[model samples]
Target chain A: MSADRLIEAYLNELATAAEALPAERLTELIADMTTHIAEARADGATSEDDVRAVLQRLGDPRDIVEAATDGLVQVDVPPRFRLRDFGAVALLLIGPFALVIGWLAGVWLLWTSDRWTRGEKLLATLGWPIGYGVAVVCDWTSIPLGLTLAIAAAITVAPLIPLLKNGQPGRSATRTRLAGATPATSSNR
Target chain B: MVAEKVFTQLRRGTLEYCVLALLQGEERYGFDLVKELGEIDGMVTTEGTIYPLLARLRREGLVETSWRESESGPPRRYYRSTASGGQALADFTADWERFRTSVDAILRRGNEGRRK
Candidate 1:
C-alpha cells in the first residue's frame, strides 16, 4: 500500500476501535494521531516503510482504544452504607410512628447527607409525614393502629426505590468504580 | 507473560509522573511530548495512548493545555504541568525513592538465595 493509504487505514482502525469513546474525546484522539503522523513525516519519514514504522510506534488501535477507555474510568469514593445513611433511612422509615420527633430527626439526617439527591429527600420527607397525618386525622380505620402504620410505612418508603435500584449492599468494587465515573461518559454533549 | 504484565502496571503507575516531570520547567506540544516520552525504554509502548493520558491529566487539574500556532503545520495543543501537578510529582518522587529501594533490596536478596 501507498504511504498515505497506510496512514489512513491505521487511523480508520483507531476510530473504529475507539468507537465507544465520547465523541469529543474520539475527535481529539484522531487529531492527535494525525498531527503525530504529519510531524513524523516532516521529520524525514517519507517512504512507505517509514510511514509504517510511525504507525507501528502508535501501537495497535485496539490497545490504544483500550488504554483510552481505561483512562476514562473514574475513581470515586464508593458509597458505603455509613452509620449516618443507616440512621437517616431508619428514622425516615420508622421514625414517623415515634410521636413525629423520630421522623423529624430522620428528616434532619436526610437533608444533611450528600448520599440521597434532593428529590429523594423531598419524597421521603413529605410522603410519610403527609400520609401519617391523613391517617391520624381520618380516624376511619377499624383495622387497628399497628396494622395501619405498617401499611402506611410500606407505602411511604416508595421514594427508596431509586436508591434500591443502584445502592446494592454488596456491589463489586469494579461496578462501583464504573458507577461514579458517569460524568465522563454522560457529559459528551 | 507475568513479567510483561508487571511492567505494564509499573509503566502505567509512573507514566503520568514521567509526563509531569518533563513538563516541569517547560511546555511541550502533544507531538513533541509524545515523541520525547516514546524515546524512553518501555515508558510509552503506544504513542497514541499519551493523548488520552494527557486529556485525563488535564481533566484532573494536574495539567493545563492551550493551543498555539505551529510554524510547521496546524495549531498545536501545548501542555504544561499545573501547580497541583508539580506538588503531586514531588510527592511521587519521594515515595518512588523509598519504593525502588525496598524493591531492589528484596530482589537482590532473592537473587542471592537462588545463587546459593
Candidate 2:
C-alpha cells in the first residue's frame, strides 16, 4: 500500500479505538496524529518502510486510546454509610412521637445528609409527615383508630424499602457503568 | 514478566517528568519531543501515547503549548514548561533522588547478601 494509504488506515484504526473519548478530546487527538505524520513525511520519511516504522513507533491504537482515557477511568468513591445517617433515618421514623420537634430534627437530618438521594429524601419527608397527619384525621373521624394506625405505619415504613436494599444506600448506576467499562488492569502486556 | 511490569510502572511514573525536563531547555514541537523520548532505551513503548500525556499535562496547567509555523510542513504545536511545571519537576527531582538512593542501598545490600 501507498504511504498515504498506510497513514489513513492507521488513523482510522485510532478513531475506532478512541470511540469512548469525549468528542472534543478525540478531535484533538486525531489532529495531533495527523500533524505528526505530516511532519514525519516532510522530514523525508517518504518511503512506505519509513511510514510503517513511524506508525510502529507510535504503537498500537488501543494502547494510545487507553493512555488518553487513563485519568477518566477513576472509580467514583461513594460516601460511606455513617452513624449520623442511621440516626437520621431513625429520627425520620420515630422523631414525631418525641414532640414533632424531633421529626423536624429528622427532616433536617434527612436534608443535610448525603446518604440518601434527593428523590429518596422527598419521599421520606412527604410520606412520614403527611401519612401521620392522615392517621390523625382518621382518628378524629368514624374510622377505627387501630386500622388508621396500621395504615400510617405502613406508609411511614414504605420509604425505607429503597434505602434498605442490601442494607446500603443506592449507588449511582452511571458510576457503576463507568467503573465496569474501564478496568484498571486493562493494559495489554 | 516481573521485570517488565517494573519497567512499565517506572515509565508511567517518570515519563511525564522527562517530557517536562526536556521542555525546560527550549520549546519543542510534538514530533521532536516524541522522537527524543523514543530514542531513550526502554523509555517509551509507544510514541503515540505521548500525545495523551501531553494533553493531560496541558490540562493540568503544567505545560503550555503554541502553534508555530513550520518551514517544511504544516504548523506545529510546540510545548514548553510552565511555571507550575517547572516547580513540579523540581519537586519530583528531589523525591526521585531520595527514592533512587533508597532503592540503590537496598539493592546493594541484597546483592551483598546473595554473594555470601
Candidate 3:
C-alpha cells in the first residue's frame, strides 16, 4: 500500500483501540502522529519500506494506547451481580420496612456514589418511601393485595432504571470546581 | 528479551528527565524531541511512545505547549518545560548522580571479584 494509505490504516487501528480515550485528546494524539509521519517523509523517508520502518519504530498501536491510559483513574463499573449493586438494590427494597435507618442507608449509598446523579439520587430517596406509604394506605383501604404489591414493585424498580442506561457519570460539584480552577490555556503556555 | 525488559525499565525511569533536559536547551516540537531521543542508543525504541509521555507531562504541569506556524507544513505544537518541570529535573539530576554512583561501585566490585 501507499504511504498515505498505510498511515491512515495505522491511525484507524489506533483510534479503534483507543476508543475509551476522550475525543479531543484522541484527535490531538492523531495530529501529533500525522505530524511525525510528515516530518519523517520530509527527512528522507520516501519509499514504502521507509514508511513501514517508521511505523514499526512507533511500536504497536495497542502499546501506545496502553501508555496513554496508564495514568488515568479508571472507574470500572461493577456488574449487576456484584456485592455493591446487590447491596444497593437490597437496601432500597427493604428500606420501607426497616423504617428511618434502612431508608437513610439506601440514600447514603445513592448520594455518595459517583455512579448516580443528584437528580437520580433525589428521586430514589423520595420515591421508595412515598411508594411504600401509598401501598400501605391502599392496604388499609381494602385494596387488592396484588395491586398494592405491584405498586410497591414499580416504585422499587423505578430508581434503578437510570442505572441501566449507558453513559459517563455526571461530574460532581467538587470536580467541576477543580476543573474550573485549572486554566485551560495552560497547555498553550 | 531479558535485556530488552531491563532497558525498557531503565528508560521508563529516566526518559522523562531526559525530555526535560532537552527542553532546557530550547523549545522543541514532538517530532524534534522524538528524533533527538531516538538518536541515543536504547533511549527511545518506539517513536510513538514520546507523544503520550509528552501529553501526560503537559497535563501534570511539567511541560507546556504552544502552536507555531511552520514554514513547510501546518502549524506545529512546540513544548517547553514549566517552572515545576525545571525544579523536578534539578531534583532528579541530583538523585540520578547518587544512584548511578552507587550502582557503578557495586558493578566495579563484582568485576574485581570476577577478575580475582
- TM-score of every prediction relative to native: 0.61, 0.63, 0.64
Model 2, A82: alpha-carbon shift in Å?
Answer: 38
- Which is the winner by TM-score between candidate 2 and candidate 3? 3
Q: Compare the candidates by lDDT and give the number of the best one.
A: 2
Model 2 interface CAPRI class = acceptable
Please give the RMSD to the true structure for each candidate, in Å: 12.5, 11.1, 10.8
Flag regions of model 1 displaced more than 4 Å. Answer: A71-189
> Tens digit of lDDT per residue, candidate 2, span B1-116?
46998899899888988999999969999999998898898899989999999988887778899998978989999999999889888888888899999999999999999999
Which candidate would rank higher by DockQ, 1 or 3?
Answer: 3
What tens digits encode model 3's per-residue C-alpha lDDT throughout A34-107? Answer: 88888888878999999999999998988887777655554443333335544655677687677777767877
lDDT of 1 at B111: 100
Judged by TM-score relative to the true structure, which candidate is superior, 1 or 2? 2
For model 1, how does the per-residue alpha-carbon lDDT over A1-189 read when each residue is reduced to its tens digit?
599999999999998887667677788888888998998898899999999999998889888777667545535545565687778788887786676899889889877776666777788788786667756754686778777767666668777666545443332222222222432321111
lDDT of 3: 0.77
TM-score (0 to 1) of chain B for each candidate:
0.95, 0.96, 0.95
Instruction: Please report how far candidate 3 places residue B64 from its true position, in Å.
Output: 1.4
Fraction of true A-B contacts recovered by candidate 1: 0.53
Interface RMSD of each: 5.8, 6.1, 5.2
Could you arrange the candidates by TM-score from highest to lowest? 3, 2, 1
